[model samples]
Target chain A: MIEIKSLVKCFGPTRAVDGLTASFSNGIIGLVGQNGAGKSTLLRLIAGVYHPDEGEVLVDGIPANDAAAKAKVFFLSDDPYTPKGADVEGTLDFYLGLFDIDVDNYHRIIKAFGLPTKRAVATFSKGMKRQVFIALALAMKAEHLLLDEAFDGLDPLIIDAIKSEIISAAEHGKTVVISSHNIFALQRLVDRFVIVSKGHVAREGNNEDIGTEFVKFQAVFSSPINEENIASLGFRVISFRKVGSVHHVVLLGNNESIEAVQKAFNPVFIEHVPLDPQEIVALEMMLAKKDQKGGEEDA
Target chain B: MLKHYISWQIRKWWPMLLIFSIILTVTALYTNAFTTMAVRYYDNGSEYVPYYSFGSTTSNMPSLFIVGLVLSLVMSLFVFSYRTRRQSVDVFYQAAYAPTTIKRVRLLIGLAILLLSMLIAFLLGTTVFLLRYVSTPAEEIKNNIKFVRISVHWGMYFLSFFLTFIFVGLHYLINCFLVSLGDYTFDQICLLIFGNIFLALCFTSPVIYFDAALMKHGVLNDYMWYPALYSLGPVGPVALVTTTMEQAIFQRDVAGDFAVNAVVSSSIYALGGIGALAFNLFVPDPSGEHADQAGARNQAVAMIPHGAAAVLGMLMAALGLINDVSVLALSILPIFGFILFSVVYYALLALWRHSFRMKKFDLICYVSVVGGTLVMLTFAMAL
Candidate 1:
């Protein structure tokens, strides 16, 4: 378990993660956000790579930066570091020497991933290197695994293999927190979602809930409805677009808002589209941007 | 595990190790061949004379040792830089080991490699000496070659190892501190250039000027005091090494005073290493962007006073040198003056940082204290 209390991490004048308070238990939690959205920073803080400027990150009630706390966690960064001349086998040995990894599990992961044991990792493709790191992380058998951009540059087959490994690790009661922009991949793997925007958690809850709450709707009206009429609806509109008489809008509200839009517009036809983790994140960012614009106009 | 890690690090450093080893082997062979040729040419009886040394005899081993030490230390910068390069920080720092432990491991590996290189060079140099002089016929040795003075020969050897180790440690400490200041490559380059310049100035023969001035005045204190003062800078260690060799190997009585100066010089280096280590600890590790901001924001407040103190000390020392005053005594004064000025300057910077206001009386007192010291020094010089 990890408890982040009012965590704030800054890089120069820019706040990477600001006053973020959250907690995670044993599960695969997906952190989804756009570029510079503080997902990586938050992961780094929990992993104890960067000390928080304010508040704290606690791992099982121990301070995250504590050696004891770090012992239970393994952070595999997006661009994994391997020495210039390091072979896959050498890199494995280097890390295994530090952590008491399960030898059988390590060998199993190596065989499953089909990574070359002798070739230098520097010569491997980016995806292959990422797989090697994934293998190493799995082998560690740490209580918590924090992976940044875990799915980048991986093929579908490799992704599936790595995803199953992560799921197995989670099933064994280890806490896995992964930060990535690949929402579809995460949607398949993670049960919980933490959506970050501009250094704060824009939304956080069960992954299914985030997907269900934010609905994408397409409606066609006989007569064009003005923008004000669409705004008057008591729902947060994430994206608003119109082609001829058809309006394509993504909204955040309960089922009542969907009904209200149907009743108000009395459209020729209305269709509700299912939302994914990516759509939820895009909608949240849109809402945050709208709020910022609204405040600026008021000022 | 530590041994495994060290061995892995050694493999990484194989290229540098090989280069140094080759240099040592070649230099040793050349020295022996040169000595044999010199023995044949200087066949005035069978004296075992060294070709390299003139009246003041000493082998080039001490110089070569210093070269190897410096090269090894320089090579370490590359190895250390790789530890923090790009994504390596995340990999290393987030490992099961603590950050300090990782740093310690790197230092140990670096020091061990440097020691290995030094030992290799020492052994090669010793082999050349033994083969060229000790193995030769006794009659031939006695006729042309005078045996090296045990004290000078052994002292040089000891100084080479001692000074090189201290220097490598000091160099490591400085790099560790400086790398935290900014961009790693930029900081390393700036430090290297700055260090070279500082060393050049230190070795610029401030002692030579003082020695000449004293020698011209027929001062009896010329031999010991002037050399000791000169040994205060970077040249001090080099002088200490060479002088010890000169006294013990060449059997020069005049070198005894120099050997004393060399001891003082070695102490200064030891003190310097301690100071660098203290400062290295004082500076926080360059972990996050916070340190970068803080370092940049406080650059003037932190660095200006120290820079001012150094420049002022140099000016005062130059004045002492130009006035042909007591160089030994004056050299000591500049060091004390540097400390005093640095303390005062730093206190003022602290006040400025805190926006502390001084009363008119307090301001007057500070000015008087600073001005009074200069005035008193000038008065003393006039007297």
Candidate 2:
């Protein structure tokens, strides 16, 4: 179990992560957020790479930034470390030596990764390197696995291979936290997530609850409606994706907002959006927008 | 596993190893050719004397080796950069799992390289000596050929390997340290490059000096107090093979020369191996990134002031001036820069260290130590 609380980090004039709190235990946590959402920073803090400015990150109630705490978590970054001038065997052996991985474990992972047993790692492909990392991490037996976009740069077959490993690790009572942009793809893998918007835990719960609570009801109006009328519907449209004439607006409100939309527009297309749990990610952001710092900045 | 590590090291670096070997052999051959050519073609009657010495009465093995070593460094750089991002060669643990002690693994590999170099040097040198002896005309020349038939002594090769191993091992080990540091700037990268050059020169200079000395006596132990005594120790035995060639092959009475060469070569072998062992200790391993500097951070706040650091630095510079005013005059910028870097770094470390909440006793002790050291250094400079 990994627990994070009161985490705050600030860049010169802006707060990157402000008063955030969340917890995960014995399951996958899909930390979904936008590009500059502080997900990586949060993960690093937990990994002991970055210490929190205030508050603490913990694993099983022990301080996470401590050395022993870090040992329990394996944070695999999107950018991998390539050892200088070593062949495949040398590279693997070096890591195996460093990690104190058993000899049997080393041989097993070498074969499992599908990396050549004797070739230089320099000769291996990018996908092959990722496999090496997976193999090493798997053999190391870390209880918490953290990945930042592990799916990128992998072929579908390798992806399945990695996914199976991740699932297996989780089944052994490990906690996996994956950060990515594609919430829909993540939906199939993650059991729950801490929805982050504007640098705080805006929402944290089951996917089913997130989808039921936040609904985006769309309607084609006969004429332009005033902001007050739209506000009266007791719904909020954070942003919308436009395809020609139709605007697929995102809203954070209860299901009643659909009826309000149908009454106001009286349009031809009144199709109900089958409660897509994935859609709640956007809705969660819409709701969190209330506390946005409201400044345009890119990290 | 360790044996396989060497195999991997050798296989991947076979081209480099080949190039190094070929260059070394060619240099040895070139020296022999130069001596032979001078004797055969030079008009001077002195050239024909079998016992005639070159300009310094010492063979030019050192000069040739300088060129060969340059070639080796170039090869190493190519290897380092080309595969910098690919495979990591880590030292494994005792249980045959992954590398256990980074230092031990590096040293172990360094030993292997030393042993390999020694074996190669002995074989090549001994073969050339025997060939030269067989070709000589007189029975006495063949007998004297033993003097020139020196192979790199086991001792000299050992020393050379030991010293060279550290530099070579460091070439790989520091990568882990630099990677572990993780927050390196372009300047730091440049610094690392410069550091490597300095390190290479420091380690290789000894070996080079010994090479020069070995040319005369065909023995590694002959040269003392030469820079990189350790370096010279390893390769000294090989020099015996080069030194005795003229007397052993060309001179009619050569048994005496062969005996001397054997003695010198053996000394080199012994010293070289011992020195290589010491050099291996300094190699830094990069594999343990996480825990290596786990404590380096969170301890930056307890240090002395920049101004004080500057003054003491200048005092050291003044002493370094010796009798040459001009040398001292030109040294200002470099000296000042060194001082400035130290001062700023120490202060920064203090601040970084302070950021972590400290327990009362630890904080008090840290503050006192930092404060006291800075004050003492400043006062000494002031006086």
Q: Put down candidate 2 lDDT per residue, A1-299, tens digits, no spaces.
A: 88888998775466778888888788888888887778866776676555577778888777875545655776766665556667655665555433434456656766866777666676678888777766666665567877876776677788777777777767778788888766765756778877777567777776555666655645566665444556667776565565655546655665667677777766556555665666677667656665463433321
Candidate 1 residue-wise lDDT, B140-232, digit = tens: 345685544222235445555566546555555544444433334534444444343343345334454445445555663635244433332
Give the lDDT of residue B62 in candidate 1: 48
Worst-scoring 10-residue span by lDDT in model 2 chain B: B86-95
Per-residue alpha-carbon lDDT of candidate 2 for residues B303-346, written as tens digits (9 for 90 to 100) = 22222233334333332332222254323343453455455545
For model 2, what is the alpha-carbon lDDT of residue B375? Answer: 44
Question: Candidate 1, which CAPRI tier?
Answer: acceptable
Q: List per-prediction Cα lDDT, in the order shown.
A: 0.64, 0.51
Q: How much is the lDDT of residue A285 in candidate 2?
A: 61
Regions more than 4 Å wrong, model 2: A3-22, A40-71, A75-140, A153-165, A196-202, A218-224, A232-251, A255-274, A286-290, A295-299, B1-383
In candidate 1 the C-alpha lDDT for residue A133 amounts to 86
DockQ of 1: 0.36
lDDT of 1 by residue, A207-265 (tens): 66765666677888877775578678766677788887778887766667768988998
